[model samples]
Target chain A: MEDTNSTIYALKTSAGQERNVARLLARKARTIDGIGISSILVPESLKGYILVESSTKIDLRNPDLKVQHLRGVVEGSVGITFDEVKRFLKPEPIISSIQKGSIVELISGPFKGERAKVVRIDESREEVVLELIEAAVPIPVTVKADQIRIIQKEAD
Target chain B: MKACTVCKMISSKDHCPSCGNPTSDNWSGLLIITDPEESRVAKELNIEIPGEYCLRVR
Candidate 1:
């Protein structure tokens, strides 16, 4: 499990049954009062584990009847636990507009902090292809759209 | 230069309509795909026929 702003814990289960546990956990989480299911990324691997996204902390550590019931659902040993789902939920920053001739500053790359003109925009992937005017080669470059900040044009 | 959506090439308008790629007004950042041969992104992404490419287009 990944360790980031979100905490991801391990739940013991038979090999090749991680996906089943994930699905069952999602269902159970949904039924739990005040626990809202956000997203799940169940990879196709025995070592894989379920990812549950929620704002409030969950009580999956109970070793009582709920654990046995969860195990029965999977036909194997099971214990509901936590995994780093916060990384998956980390929000991507937003932007307003990207247009031609707009001045921008490169946030990352060999030309980090350098300014360039916005010649084209790829809205789908949220990246910008820029042409370096000050550089000797004046070559074009591509970078994530969030990497740049629009330079507000001033009155001529 | 009118950018070819598929090829990312900057060419004269009404000519060189990128025969294989896509075109759209939604392109965000304009980047020249210079040195597509040496560029890691170009090689990994299999982008050929260099030109202006939208870095991020909706």
Candidate 2:
């Protein structure tokens, strides 16, 4: 059941109007016929451009697209792959200042006010696996990197 | 030593008390939400505890 309407295209909309245009496109797709639109995304890091995944190339002159004064895709660029947007879509860690063996305090989770040691770092999830040094059993818990404070450094 | 970029809670401890997001010394605008339930701005920002907070964290 492969669908022909599976290509992703880009649109040039006004900066900060991305969400609005996305909402409009979503609504139009639901009510219009042969819109062939599958999904729409407006990345925060990127402004003035919205990515639209659809089976067919959207017509800029289509009234349902609400392209009044809103820009559309450029010529010779009708399809884009995941790799094209991956660079801008990837998420970076919230707190990259942490180091291994550093003593950190659990500040917000169930183990609030408790201290722990950095056991491992999971940069992809922006989380850290910590060994609770203050606990009787020394439980290991994974939490957001920002959830723990570096109480002491390994050097000290 | 840092404050949460999301919740803006400041701490010598390095983590935010409200939200578990990262806290950084790279924050500006000091604030204290003692009554997150009563303070309009605190409620607006989703702060729910009495603690030192910063307005912006980079």
Provide backbone clash counts, one per model.
28, 5
lDDT string for model 1 (A16-93, tens) is: 665455556555544555543333333322253443333344445543215322332222354333323222222233
* Residues A1-156, model 2: lDDT tens digits: 122325557788887777667767766776787877655556655678877766666888777777543587845634576567454333344557788888889889798998888888887667899998867887789998767778887655
Docking class of 2: incorrect
Candidate 2 regions off by >4 Å?
A: A1-5, A67-69, A87-90, A96-156, B1-58
Instruction: For candidate 1, give the lDDT of residue B14.
Output: 39
TM-score of each: 0.29, 0.43
How does model 2 score on DockQ? 0.02
Ten-residue stretch with the least lDDT total in model 1 chain A: A1-10
TM-score of chain B of each: 0.55, 0.76
Worst 10 residues of 2 chain A by lDDT: A85-94
